[model samples]
Target: MGKLKLLIVDDVEDNRLVLRAICKKLENFEIKEAEDGLEAVEITQDWLPDIILMDVMMPKMDGYEASKIIKNLYPQTVIIVVTAVTDPNMQKNMSEIGVDTYIHKPIDKELILFKLQSIGASIRLKQGQFKTLSKKNALNPFNSDIRSFRIIFDITDTESMMDFGMWLFDQCADKDVVACGRLDLIVELFYKLMRQGMKNQENLSIIVEESYEEIYITIKFENIIVLEPRMVDILNAFESEFIVQKNILCAKLKKYIEEKNSNFEAERTTLTEETIQEIVELKIVKEIHTAPSKERELLRQSFTQKTCAADYVSDIGGDIVDEILDLASLDEEWRERLTTFEEIPSDDNLKKFANGVLDVYAHTINSLFEFTALAYALTSLGIFLKEKAHMVVQDPAKIKTLIMLLENLGYDLVAWRKHIFELQDTLDIHYLDSSFFSSCMQIEGIMSNKEIDVDDDNDMEFF
Candidate 1:
C-alpha cells in the first residue's frame, strides 16, 4: 500500500500537473493522471487506485456523473470530488453522487495532503483491515481497534439491583491506577461491560454488560442476600453524592455496591433492552429528584421502562402492582391463620410499628429530598401511623403509655439526630444549632408552666 496508487483527474492539464507535483512529496502513493471524467472512468476499470482525486467540471461527462457511475460499478473505490464551484446546489449534487469527500479547488498543499491522509486511512477501514492501522499507527487518534474488547456482569438480587447498578456507574470516576476512565465515559463503558457479561453462559444468574470504544467490563450474580439498614443507607448516601453533590468525586459507586452486596448470587446474561430498562428503573430513577419537572418526567420514564418489559414470572417483569399483589396474595393458608387484630403497644407490636415507620420515612426522604414541607408532612404522618399501630395493644385514651414506650426506645433521639444531620448539611450549622436549642428551651418553658402529672391520662401532641 506504499505510495497510495493515486489517480489525478482534471479537465485542465495545468491542474493535473500541479496536483501530481505536490503528490510527489508523499513517499507512499503512485500518481496517475486522467483528463476529464470519461478517461478517468476508463482507467479506473482496469487499475484500482487506493484513492481517486477527481475534478468536477469537464466536457462530455461531468465529475458528478462519472463519480456516480464509478461508485455504482465499484463501491469499494474511494472517490473524492475536486471542485472550485461553491454553489450550494452543485455541492449538494456532488454529495448525492456518493463522493467519498468534496475538496474545494485553489487548494493549499497542506490541506490537500491532510485530506489525502484521512481518505487513505478511511479506505483501509472500509477494506476490513482496521487492525492493520492500529498496529502501524501508534498515535492514531481514532483507536477504533480496541472497540472489540468487551465484558459483562450480572447480579441475582433484584431488590439490591439498583444499589449495585449505581455503584458500578461510579467506578468510572476512579482516578487511581485501578480506575478505568472519566466519569461520563466510565458510566457509558460500564453499561457496555454489563451487556457483554451477559453473553458468557457460565455460573452467572444475572449479568451486567458494558462496552466502550476501547474498553468493556461486566459483573454477574444470582439472588441478593439480606442487607442491614445501615449498609443500605450508606450505599444510598453514596448514590446521592454521585448524583447530588456538585463537586465530590473520590469514591467508586460500583466498588461500594460489590462490597456491601457480595453475598448475593450473580450470573451472566446478554443485556437486552428489557434488562437496561429494569436497571434504569430500579437504580437510576431511585437516586435523584433535584427538579420537580425532571423528577416527574424521570419517574414516568422509569415506569414506562418497567411497564414495557416482557411478562415473565420470577423475573423482572413490568408492573409493580402485579408483583406486590402476587407477593401479598401468595400462601393463602398461612395468611388465613394469621390474626387480623393485634395489640400494638406490647414489645413485639411496638417494634413492628417502629420498623414500619422507619421504612416509610426512609423511602419518602429518598424520593422527595428537595421539598421540606412534603418531607415534614410525610414524617409526621409516619409518626401518626406509629401511634395508631401502638393503640391496637393499649387503650386509645392512654396514648401517653405509647409515647413513653417510644421515648424509652430512643425513638425521639433517632428522629432528632436525623433532623440535626439533615439540617447540618443543608444550612449553616451554627445558626441551625442555635435555633434548635432556642426552640428546645422555649418548649421546656411551656412544659414547666403546665401542671400535668406524668402518670395522668392527659394526651398531648408534641408536634
Candidate 2:
C-alpha cells in the first residue's frame, strides 16, 4: 500500500514545521504543506491528501471556509483543525464545517500520536469492510456459455439483501464486467420490486442472466402484487412532464440564439466578409440539442469503458441523486433564498432568515453523510412496508396509497440529497476565496443569533 498522504495548512511556517516534525515520527506518511486556505484548496484539487491539519485563522481564506469546500468535494478526507482559538463558538463553527477533530496550537506529541493512531485504525476498518463485502461471494459471471445465477432471500433480511447485492458486483468484477453504476441500478430495481411485495415462499429472487450482447436482470417471487399498470402510468406521466419541460427549455434556448443572431447581423456591416463567413460556419458547427434520442445509448457505451465495479458504485448513488434533484428543481428556491439572503429587503429579512436556518439544517445533514445512508435505508423501509401491506392490507386503495407514499418519500430523499450537493457545489464554484469567507461569516452570524438546540428526536428526520 502507498503511504497515507497528510497535508499541513498553516500560515505560520513554525506551526507547519511543528506538525511536520510530529508527522515525520509517524509511520508510512507522506507530508505536504500549504501556507493558507487558498493554497490548501489548490493542493487538494491534485494531491487529495487522506488527512489535513488546518489552521482556523489565516490570510486570504480562513480554515472554516476552506474546510467546508474540501469536505463538500471530498467527504471521505479527514480534517483536523489545529488552531490557538479554543472558544466554544469557534469549536462549534469548526464542527459545523465538518472538521473531524480539533487540536490545540501548543500541540502535545502523545495527543497527536493517539489521534493519528485512532484515525488510522478507523480507516483500516472501513477498508476491511469493503474488502470483505467484495470477496464474500466468489461467483464468476464470465462463463463462455450464456450464464445465469439466482439467489432467494427473505425481504426482511437487510443483511442478506446487502450481501446479495455486493455478491452480484463481485461476480461482475471476477468476470471483468465492470458493474459499478450498472450494479447500483440493478440493486435499486430489486429494492423497487421488493417494495411492491415480490416474494416467493416468503423470499424474493434476484436473477442475473448474461449474454454476448447484453445482461438482463429480473427480480421475481410467487404471488407478487404486480402494480405494473399503475407504475407505467406514473412513469408515463413523469416522461410527459419531462418532455414538456425540455420543450420549454429548448424554446428558450432557440429564442436566445435568434436574438444573438439578430444582434450579430446588426454588427455584420462592421465586419469583413471573411470574418462573417467564419462566424456563420462556427455557428453552424455548434448546433445544440436539448434532448438527444441517442443519449441513453451513448451512456451505455461510456459504461463499457470502466474496469472496476467497486470503484464505480462509490459515487453512482450520489451522482444519480444530484441529477434527479437538479432536474426536479425541488430545492432551487431554498438555495437561491439562502445564497441571496443579505440582498433581501429588511421587510422580508425575517422570512429569508428562516430559509437560511433551513439551509443550515440541509448543510448539517449533508456534512453528516446521512443522505447516502438514508437513500438505502428508505429502500429497505419501503420493502418492509410493502410486505406488511401485502399481508395485512385487504383494501386495494390503501395498498396503492402506501406504495405511492413510499415512492414519494424516495423522491423526497433524492431532492433533499440534491439540495445539499448543490449548496456545496455553489460554495465551491462561486465562493472560492473572499466570497467563501463572506458566506461563512453570514452563516456563523445566523447560527450565533439563534439558540438552536437540535435534540436526537428532531435529528431523527435525517436518518
Candidate 3:
C-alpha cells in the first residue's frame, strides 16, 4: 500500500546525497543514509529497511562483509551492492555473499529506479504472499505459473493427421496461441507424416518383432487457457478427427511389414545392439517428458541462466504467442509466406488475410521473429492503461478495441466467442486511465492520419 523503506549505504557523501535526492523524488520512501558498512549494520539494527542499497567497497566493513552480516541478521532484506569494480568475477562473488543485485559505478538514474521498483515489487509480493495463497491455493506464481498436459493419439492414416491438424487448429483458434499449442500440432503432424512415410508391407526392408510406440511433443503457453479448460478439450478433439482406428490399424500394419521384411533384417545382426541402444534412448526420452516439469525447467533455465543476457519471456512477451497461433492455424508454406508481410502478394485471399494480421502484429520485427498478432496488438493496446486497471479486473479500452478488431477480422466463428469479447469489454470498461486514453488518441491519430484538436487556451500533455 505504501512505498518501501530503503536504506542507502555508501562511504561517499556525494553518492549518498545523489541517491537520497533520487529516492525522495520517487512516490514513497523512508530513506536513511549510512556512511559505511558499519553504519549500515547499526542502522539496520534500529530500522530495518525493506531493501538495502550497499556500496561494495565501503569503509569500516566493505559491502561483502556488511551484506553477509545483514543477511544473517535480517534474511528478508534484499541487499543490492553498488560498486565501481569492473571485474567480471566481482558481481558473481557479491552474489555468492547474498547480494541480490549489483549496480555498477556511475549508475544511471533510470536504471536505479528500475531496480528499486523491481525490488519493491518483490517485497510487496512477499508481504502479500499469504493473502495470495489463501485466495488461490491452486495458482502459485512460483509453481502454478506453468502447466503441462499431454494428449497422445494413435496415428494410422496420413489423411487422419491432416484432419487432426485442422481440428487442433480449430480448438486453439478461439484461445490465444501458445508455444505448447504449436508443439501439440507438430507432434500430431509429425506422427502422421512418419506413419505415411512408413513403407507398405511388401516394400518394407527391415522390421522389428517388438511392438513400437509413438510419441510426439507439443508446447504452448498458459495464456491460451487463461479462462477455463474447455479450450483443452478443443485441442484434444483433434484425436477423434483422425478417423482411422489407430491401435488396430497400426497393429495390422506392423504385422504386415514384419511378415514381409522377416528375411532381410538377419543380415544386419551387428547393428542390433546399436539399434537397441537407440530404442532405449528414445524410451528414456519419452519417460523424461513428465508432463510440464521438464518443459518448464528448460524454459526457466533458458530465460534465467547467467549465460543468457535477456529475459526471454519479458523480451518476446506476448508476441510469440500470437505468431504461434497464426502458425498453428496455417500450413508450413503459409507460415513462411507470412514471415515477410512487406507487400500483399496478389496470389491468394488467405495470404492477404495473413498479411493483414502480420501488419498489425509485427511491431518489433527484429526483436524475435518479425511478426505480430491480433492478440498481441490487442494486449499491447491495454498496456498504457494496465496500471490504472490494477484495481479493476481488466482494461476497458483494450477490450473494446479487441472486440472491434476481432469483429472486423473473421474471428467470430467459434462457439461462445462472444463471451471472450464480452470479457475483454468488461476489463476495458473498468480500468482505462487518462494516460491510456491519451495514448489511444495518439495511436488513433497515427492510424487515421488525423490531428488532435488542441484548444488555444488549454494545455494538454500528450502521452
Candidate 4:
C-alpha cells in the first residue's frame, strides 16, 4: 500500500495546521488541507482521500452536511470529526452523519494517532479494494458525477439491485429485446461474483458513472474466487471493455445508452395521445431491433481470451437450460424423489430416487450430443444406486454422502432451470462439469469403497 491520503477539513487555518502537524508526526500520511466542508466534498470528488479529519465548526457547508454527502458518495473513505462540542446530542449527530470517530478540540496527539493508525492498518489489510483510475474506463473523475455505493446488496434482489449491468438490462431492455435476457444474465452473474468476492468484507461496492452514451463502473473487490472452472469461463465470457489490475475491475459498458434517431418523431401529424404513444413504442422497438444489431454483436462476442476450461471441456458457451427444455420439461419429480430418499434412506426410497434420475436422464437428456458425457455420468450414478440400493441403505454414513451430493446437484439443476425458464435472468453452467462430475465420482468412490480426491486444488488464473 502507498501513503495513506488524509484530508484535513477545518475553517480555522491554525486548526488545520495543528492536525497537519499531528499527522506529520506520524510520518505516514500524504496530507491535504480543506478550508471548509464544501472544499472537502469537492476535493473528495477527485482525490478520494483514504481518511478525512473533519471539523464540526466550519463555514459554508458545516461538517454534518459534508459528512453526509461524502459518506453517501464514498462510504469507503473514513471520516473522523475534530470538535470542541462536548454535548452528547452533537456527538450523536456526527455519528449519525457517518463520522467514523471524534477527538476533542483540545487534540490529544496520542488519541488522534491511535485512531489514524487503527483505521490505516485495516485499510492496508484489505489492500486490493482501492479503486484506481483505469485507462480502459472512460469515467472522467473531474467531470463525471460518479455515484459511489458501499452497500450490503443481497444476491436475491435481482429486480431491485441497482448496478450498471442491472440498470442496463432492466431500464433499457425494453428498448432492445436482444439485450434483455442475455445482458441481464451476464450482469446478474457479475453481481454474484461481487457477493462472493466480498463475502468476508463488511461492505461490497462499485463506483458507477452513468451518462447518456455510456456507463463506467469501477468495481472494488478483494478477490473473485471462481471455485468452478465453468463459472470462471462464463464470467470470463462477458464482452464488456474491462481492465482488471490487482482486484479492481474497471469496466466500460457502451453503445446501449445512446438513442437512435427516429423519423417517426417528425412523421406523426396528429397531436393525439395515441399517436405519441405509438411514436414512443415505435422508437423503442426500432432501438431494440435495428439500431442495436451492432450493440448485440458487441455483447454476443466472448470477451475474455483466457479461460480455465480444459481441453476436453470443449463444449462451452452453451444453452444448457434451453437444451434441457427442448428435450423435456423439468418436472420436480427427480429432485423430490431424492429428497424423499433422504427422509427415509430405505432400499425402496433409494431405488425410487435412482429410478427417477434414470427416467429423467435416459428419456430426455440422452439425445443431446453435446452433453453425452454428463448423460453418461448421471446415468452411471443412477445405475450404481439401483444395483447397490440395498447395500447403500445399510450404511448411514454412505447414505449421508449420497444425500449431500444429490441435494447439491438437485438444488443447482432446479436453480438453473428456474433462472433461465422463469422471468429471472441468472444461470450457472458450473453444474455441468464441477458439481455433477465431482458428485458422481465421490458417490461411486463411496459405493466401491475407494478413496476419491474430490477436493483437488485446481487453480484458475483470472484477471
TM-score of each: 0.33, 0.30, 0.33, 0.30
Return the lDDT, model 1, position 2. Answer: 41
- For residues 212-331, what per-residue lDDT tens digits would candidate 1 score against the true structure? 101113233232322345334434534532221211111223322211111111222344453355456446522422222222222222111111112212122234224323322223
What are the RMSD figures for all models against the true structure? 23.6, 26.0, 29.1, 21.8
Q: Whole-model lDDT, candidate 3?
A: 0.41
Per-model CA lDDT versus the true structure: 0.41, 0.45, 0.41, 0.55
- Model 4: per-residue lDDT, tens digit, 70-151? 8766656777777777566775555444455566666668546645664565465447533422223332333222222111
Clashes per candidate (backbone, < 3 Å)? 51, 0, 15, 1
Model 3 CA deviation exceeding 4 Å by range: 129-463
Put down candidate 2 lDDT per residue, 45-67, tens digits, no spaces: 99999889889889999888888
The lDDT, on a scale of 0 to 1, for candidate 2 is 0.45
Highest-lDDT candidate: 4
State residue 435's C-alpha deviation in candidate 4, in Å: 43
The true-structure Cα RMSD of candidate 3 reads 29.1
* Model 4 spans with C-alpha error above 4 angstroms: 128-463
**Stronger candidate by lDDT (3 vs 4):** 4
Question: What is the alpha-carbon lDDT for the whole of candidate 4?
Answer: 0.55
